[model samples]
Target: MECPYWLTSSQVGVYGRAAPEDFTADYEHWKRVVAQSYLNGIGISWSSVRNVMDMRAVYGGFAAALRDLNVWVMNVVSIDSPDTLPIIYERGLFGIYHNWCESFNTYPRSYDLLHADHIFSKTKKKCNLVAVIAEADRILRPEGKLIVRDDVETLGQVENMLRSMHWEIRMTYSKEKEGLLCAQKTMWRPKEMEIIKSAIA
Candidate 1:
């Protein structure tokens, strides 16, 4: 059995005159792809339930993947509301899913992989995939992985930053011109700290 892949999506759906049959078929195809990659687990976080409702025509694949892969699922939104964080925590998922967008601070030193699905894009000028990589490094265990897929203009910059940080570039690919990069976190030596202390003495 191969290791499963993790997936995250942003605003993926059909709307406005697309036939229901076509919509449903496309959604199923997306889900099957997600299911096949269910190794470490699976997660889906939407900006709103309404935003995801029309998208659900594609979610049968998600549900089927969850069933076949025994993967975990989560839903989140930007605004804090009743039963939001509590529900996510109750499910034992990576909790407070909305926090990923909270003004982009560095992550605390405690997580493993930081997975981003469709968060970055050429049209939308908001998300920073490199900051996300830094945050993942700050929080991940040594040799951990960061999985990201997005519409990026500078794949080389992402790869270069990871290498400068001593992270290993594991994989990269293109899907319809969108670049996906997979990098592994590596241990950072405290050589500078040691040298500074020795000089002071």
Candidate 2:
């Protein structure tokens, strides 16, 4: 088979867009490394996690990177970002356009896992972050995992919100200004809600 010229380190494909440091010859390998490390840390069983979403997909590299995994990735390009949905389809992957400030058009607990790369920083300037966090809680399954990579400040704020929802903060790491947070959602109910249910019963 003939190799695509754009797959080389020097080219940005037909879109001619993507992070400059991204998509080197080792791009896919780097993603595989990241996926392996995080999955090992979280102890996710591939048998259970069938569907995944890349919330801030740029050039669909994250999806391309996970080709070896026994999972499917839905690349979501933020409406605020470049319109690269065409490129995603061109690569024979899946994708959609979305605005994080608004709720995604799907039922609750749709995704088994979510990879949010720098989504908070971009969405924060325009909308109430509480709404965004609530939406995340809505879309992820009860036992689903959320992997967020964002600036340290945003991660701090995000941790507080997720904690408030009773989601377990499984792991958190930061280097200088950037940060990573892994959390697992639970079906925990508030004490007040339980009391109300008891009274009704």
Every model's TM-score: 0.50, 0.80
lDDT of 2 at 139: 83
For model 1, residues 1-201, the per-residue Cα lDDT tens digits are: 111122213323333222344335644655655555524242322221111111011223333334434333333332322223432333333333343323333243343444544443321244454554454455556765665666655566667777878888877877676777777678874365322231122
How many residue pairs collide in each prediction?
4, 0
Clash pairs, model 2 backbone = none
Candidate 2 local lDDT, 9-127, one digit each (tens): 56454335333334343355447656767657656666788789989887777777777788888899988786768767777889999988777877433999988988987898988
Candidate 1 regions exceeding 4 Å error are 1-30, 35-109, 122-124, 127-130, 152-154, 189-201
What local distance difference test score does each model get? 0.44, 0.77
User: Superposing every Cα of model 1 onto the true structure, what RMSD results?
Assistant: 11.4
In candidate 1, which residue pairs get closer than 3 Å at backbone N, Cα or C atoms, i.e. clash? 4-38, 4-39, 5-37, 27-58
Query: What TM value does model 1 have?
Result: 0.50
* Cα lDDT, model 2, residue 90: 71
